[model samples]
Target: MLKNYVAYVRVSTTKQFIHGVSIAEQRRAITQYATLQQLNIIDWYEEIQSAARGRRPVFREMLKALKRHHYGLIMHKIDRGARNLRDWADIGDLIDEGIDVRFTFYFFGGVVWRGTDKKIERVFLWIGGSPP
Candidate 1:
C-alpha cells in the first residue's frame, strides 16, 4: 500500500558538477527507478556533505520529512547515506518505524531486512565490499 516516493542524491564536494558527473549520474539513476516503478518523486534532496559528517543539513531535512510520514525515501546508493554506525542506526530506526527505503542499486538483489540479524551482514558489506 506504499505510494509516496522521494529521491535523494549527494556528493561530497560541490565541484562535482565541474569535475565529474556524480550528481548527474545519481539523478539519472533515481529517475530511472521512479520511471520503472511509475512513481512520481515528490522531492529530490541533494546534499554536499561527506558520509562521515552525521549532521548534514539536507540529510536532517530529509529525515524530518520522512518522520512527518508521507512518502518513503530513495537514494542512489547506501554509502551515499552514512559511513558511521550512528548514522546507520538513525536510518535503521526510520526503517523500524515503517519508512520505506529503496536503493538505486540492490547489489544483493533487494534484500530487505526487517530484523537485526541481517544488519551484521550489511555492516560486513559496508566495510569490505568489492567494487560492483
Candidate 2:
C-alpha cells in the first residue's frame, strides 16, 4: 500500500530564505526522499519560525491535519522538526498515536528515518547515489 505524507519546511531567518537556504531546497530534498520511498505527499506546510519556540501555528495546524487524516509527517531533519525537548515530546506523542515520522536528510549517512515501531530504529537509506 502507498503511504501518505505531509511535508514541512521551516527557516529560522530571512537570510536563510534569501541566501539559497530557501524552502525550495527543503521541499526538494523531501521530494527526493519521498520519491525514493514511493510515498505520496498529501500536503505541505512551510513556516518561518524558530524551532526554539514551541508555539508554531502552521506546525500546529499540520499536526491537527495529520491526526485528522491519519497521515504520516515528513521533515528535512530532526532539528528542523523540533528543537526543544517539549517540542520533541509533542512529536513523541504523535508517534505514540501511531503516526509515522520520516526525516528526509540526516548527517548519519541516510536520507530517511522511519519512526513507527515500538522502538525507533535508525535505518540507513541513500536516495540518489552513493552516500557522501
Deviation from truth (RMSD, Å), model 2: 7.8
| Residue runs of model 2 more than 4 Å from their true location after superposition | 117-132
lDDT of 2 by residue, 94-123 (tens): 887888898877522443346664334221
TM-score of each: 0.75, 0.81
The superposed Cα distance between candidate 1 and the true structure at residue 128, in angstroms, equals 17
lDDT score at residue 119, model 1, on the 0-100 scale: 62
The segments of candidate 1 whose C-alpha lies over 4 angstroms from its true place after superposition are: 18-21, 107-132
Candidate 1: lDDT of 13? Answer: 82
What do the candidate models score in CA lDDT, each in turn? 0.73, 0.77
Error of 2 at 132 (Å): 29
